[model samples]
Target chain A: MSDASQGASALTPEVKGIIGATAEKIEASFPWGIEREGLRIFTQAIMDPDPRYWDDEFAAKTKFGGIITPPIYCTYIGRRTRPGADDPITRAFEENPYSDGIQGVRTPETRGGLPNIPTPLVRTLNAGNEIEVRQYPKLGDRIFSQAKYADIKERVGKDGSRMLIVTTETVYTNQNDEVLCILRASSIRR
Target chain B: MTTAQELRDKKQTWWDDVDVGHEFPPLVIGPLTSTHLFRWSAAIENWHRIHYDQSFAVYHEGLPSVLGQGSWKQSILPRYLKDLCLPDGWPWKVSFQHRAMIVPGDTLTIWAKVTKKYQEEGLGFLDLDVGMRHYAETCPGRATIVLPIRNGKPIPYPFVPPKKLSEQTS
Candidate 1:
């Protein structure tokens, strides 16, 4: 944590100005297009044998008419992999484990995830999410996403430690620009 | 008690047959290992160390062990709910909070009990009380799903939330 002695102003005037600003060209698109296996693996990993994700015959008869990606699938599609050799995951373990890990590719031209929020503090914990789904991405559909810092608030922890609650809203859309889902995620940075 | 095999073979649930107090089969996801967390974090491209580095998670964060990713944990809710209301239903709006931490080697049961079932604008809907737990309830949340009525037309694709449900509290 860097200089929390500033109290709430630790938000830094510069960080407060960028609220509602959308990161430009920070495209979170899936070039792979939704596929059957991706759907199966996701559900299976979670131990949900929802036939709609696996059983072709069962899914064929569903309202979806066939396999459909799980609603939360879009949440995972908002990230981009690094270019060429040394993927983010591999690099995460190979380098100093104590480091901040791989640089976020979300803002390729900028530093850090969902740039413009330079809180004086580090260490963020996933608080939770409020998601309203307009639709689920279908198989063969390529998902496109853009994100923005919706809000930021400061709070004092039970221990009297100051924390910043950062909320980001990422909107997912299909190739047709039809909205697929909107995820509002909040994290506590202390 | 619900078993994995039964869940695999169980047919989709319909709004008509579901009772207000009905509890679908519980979906048990893990005695999750570090690999499980790694796979999940990898799939989502979330490189948060608390999820993968035991030392970082323990010594640094003061956690008992490497913790599970809340995003990964919450994401599984839809799969459990969908399995209970599939073929002719949709897992619509869902909200949940992490509330607590989950460590490796812990198995979590995701459960949903129908709290209410209603019809409006010629479509059927069910409000569910949902949650996840190991030794205790770690994530308590709710989901409102659209289910088909008997043989009624499939819940509209790209599901549109009925106006009546707009202001309904969870």
Candidate 2:
């Protein structure tokens, strides 16, 4: 990371300081378990007509013993606040009406309790993700996540512009601490 | 009362059914609306304003219009890929880069084309180059899908991966 990345506006020492920092485990629950309604709308949103997602009788006949989630749910809807916890939604709007709400000045959205890395870049975008689809989290499972700043680097784009690319990895687990999936997510800030 | 192989094949996307250049049927969604974006935002619990606040997105953020969450755009890709593999097989690994922004009213057509194929742990694997577009390829990347081979056993429930394939394997 030293030699090859030296050509551009390299990352500042403060930015580089976060490379291997891992966050404490964040425990959030699906108190009512994973909701069937959530499953329906998500599949509807994607236009997935698979009977496994929609058919009750058919799902009952499968090895999963009942309706199972569409594995990708591990990333999208798996985590939620613990019961009796503060509402992040209500908090965001109350905090800043005009804020983008994702990375606002008061608070930036952290993934699975990963700590924030302060950067000079104002705007952020979800660059993409490297995901390993592992075990499926069942309905009524409490989802816990532990995250880390896998890497933070500077890159010179085609127009000689520089931006900081941040990558984070989060592991999702059930209440029993059974591993469900590992997601390597990256975002570009400029 | 089902064999593991039978349970697996119930939703199996056949390894024998594909080749290096095979293309999965595309999933077309949208002429997206703010309503669509808002519901998704609420569902995922990502309360970002760009997804719902038009005035803020246009004037303050300098965006073309109220934007769709990249994660929402991302949700479409793997859902299609997983169904393509179905029942027994898994959309084992996929990576995507959200290059272009998705605005309201943009129709997204998600696609994947097989790039490589191999065998490991007695299961079949196929690599694919994928894209999400509204005429231009906005988000692009690759994925590796695990599938059941002809007359092979089930691919397992917890979806165990083989010994580290390679950094570039996906």
Candidate 3:
């Protein structure tokens, strides 16, 4: 076939090793904690004014039972303890020379102020996402995540470039085996 | 003191007499940081170190912080459409394309304009061009949504065939 396909096929072995190694590392420790403050930060960032996330009284009356976190709040549930430095995604982009153009802090021309993060990376573009929620986590709930590299493969687009497709699956759960959410995402490394 | 009832009562519906060119309400989002990025990673079960570790980000490719997830941007679209349209406005189809990255502290303004309206099979459909613009640079992403008009009935499935076929001999 083409060079891209051959390159992708050659990567299967290496990708498997990476996935297995990363899964073992993540499963061994609880990387982060889910808390109310984190919930507020995430919800406010999205500009969601739902009382369920802000007011305890209104949340109590809703079907959610109590201070229920927003559905999108699931994005911020993890905490990392080890490296004790910059965020992992940022580091991934910074290290890769090909991605430098996409990552960095930008200025808002209209507002005339510093952007929230001094440097932002548009490094990883969206390949696709699948989300299934079993139950919503309420305020004060403690949760953990099990992350693993699900699969990796390659494809050649009509443009003739070999693209590496990496798929990862993460399952979130409470102290009980009750699944909170299951997220599967794919990224393209070209 | 203003009561929650007053706040809830102030919620507007699309039926409250809307103008075609009027802009939908504006929304401010993010003073985002690595913390939020990490939380998103943990919640999404993404262990990509770039989101939480600044050193990894800077040393590796030189990013300021972990990048925001693209799916998060896509998910925000439905909510924006729901807010702009009335409760009776039901979405039939939605398509999105991510043209740029949304980092922490980016204020996004989401708005939509009713483009076309037509009646098909006793159902009313409004075509909308929905958009999200980064207030800082005016970089925006847009989508087209086919939504059902308020109080309109849904079109029935298995529409009659347009033409009759000739009888076949067994």
Candidate 4:
């Protein structure tokens, strides 16, 4: 754990300024597309024993009263890997089976899982995810989202390594533009 | 005695049943294996080699072993909270961080203890401390859920939050 100390100002005014700024891209048509089969696989993988996610008949009788996907779909909604959209990461997968892992891929890129932070601080960890749901996403509702760098702050870790905690908030909506949920995803970068 | 699974199956976790410090029945999954991780990766289309590539992860990356996906671990707590609501209630929000690395063989207990309960907008709300504990608390976070009071109206369909979505931004 090399403590690359650029001090607290490592956020470089340019970096700090990007905080609260919306990503240049407003992503639409996610890879999964919030479909039923995809959600079935996604939800069942954890084996929650939640009948709503597993049993269609039970879900239909619930308040949702229709095919509804879990709200967790909000996180993976806008990934740019829909079949052959040709993002860099997608290209990497296309060309090589043994390519580099998704190290720099997920850090700052609000869309495409491409890193967007303009700083020397590169290593990133999943700090946390905070999601507020107005609704559980129903199958067949078209999804759209806008993401912003909600906040960025610097602090020293327990081992004395300085880390920048970057938070990006993405608000998801349906094709009708009705709000669905808000996800505040925080990461530790050093 | 009424079992927790019975409540989940019947969708009957009423407001009277929850108090601060009340614990939700733990939802345990695995002694997970590589196939479990691959199934998740295939389902999500996440090809990050660390999740499934044991050679690359252990030999190249030098991780203890092929690690469980962060996304998978993160989803456990939220899913647990969501299931607690069943038919009528709603999982308003959940937040958690991956504090420890989990390898393939870890048996996970997705668990929570109610920390607070209150009524708002005629809806019953529960706030809880949640975790995915495998030997230690590997993932820890907070979750808030909305449920119906014993005999009051069921939680609104599609959930009408106390605040507007616009206000919830940031």
Q: Which of the numbered candidates is closest to the native, going by highest TM-score?
A: 4
- Each candidate's fnat, listed in order, reads 0.60, 0.64, 0.04, 0.61
Better of 1 and 4 by lDDT: 4
Model 4 C-alpha lDDT per residue in residues A1-190, reported as the tens digit of each score: 3324543456678777777778543546553456767777877676554566556776687677776766777667554355654465655656665675464333344443323777677888877889888887777777777778889998876756677899988778887777788889888888
Model 3: runs farther than 4 Å from truth?
A1-33, A80-128, A149-153, B1-97, B101-107, B111-131, B134-170
Model 2, span B1-170: residue lDDT tens: 12223333545568998899998877778788998888887777666678888888888889998888877767777777776776677888788887877888888888899999999878899999999989688889898888888889788777777776744432
Q: Candidate 3 on B1-170: residue-level lDDT in tens?
A: 12335433444343324444545565445556666666655544455556666676668858765667665565566546534432234333334455666666765666666665545454454555665677432323333223344565532221111122101100
User: In order, what lDDT does every prediction score?
Assistant: 0.73, 0.74, 0.49, 0.74
lDDT string, candidate 1, B58-135, tens digits: 898788988888778777777676667655577777778887678888889889999988888878888888999899
Give every collision pair in model 1.
none
Chain B TM-score, one value per candidate, order as shown: 0.88, 0.88, 0.65, 0.89
CA displacement after TM-score superposition, residue A62 of candidate 3 (Å)? 0.6
iRMSD (Å), candidate 3 = 9.3
In model 3 chain A, the worst 10-residue window by lDDT is: A112-121
Candidate 3 at residue A170, lDDT? 69
Tell me the tens digit of each residue's lDDT in model 2 across A1-190. Answer: 3332334464878788989899888764455657778888776665566666656677777656677776667666544444576766667667766557765322334645665676657567777787777777666776777888988878887856678888998888888888777788888877
Better of 2 and 3 by DockQ: 2
TM-score winner between 3 and 4, please give it: 4
| Residues A88-157, model 3: lDDT tens digits | 4565556764443223321112221112211111234557554434456666556656666666665666
- Tens-place lDDT digits, model 4, residues B50-162: 88889989998899998888888766666677777765677888888778888888888888889999887788888889988888988888888887787787677656777
Using lDDT, rank the candidates from best to worst: 2, 4, 1, 3
Instruction: Give the Å error, residue A33, model 1.
Output: 2.2
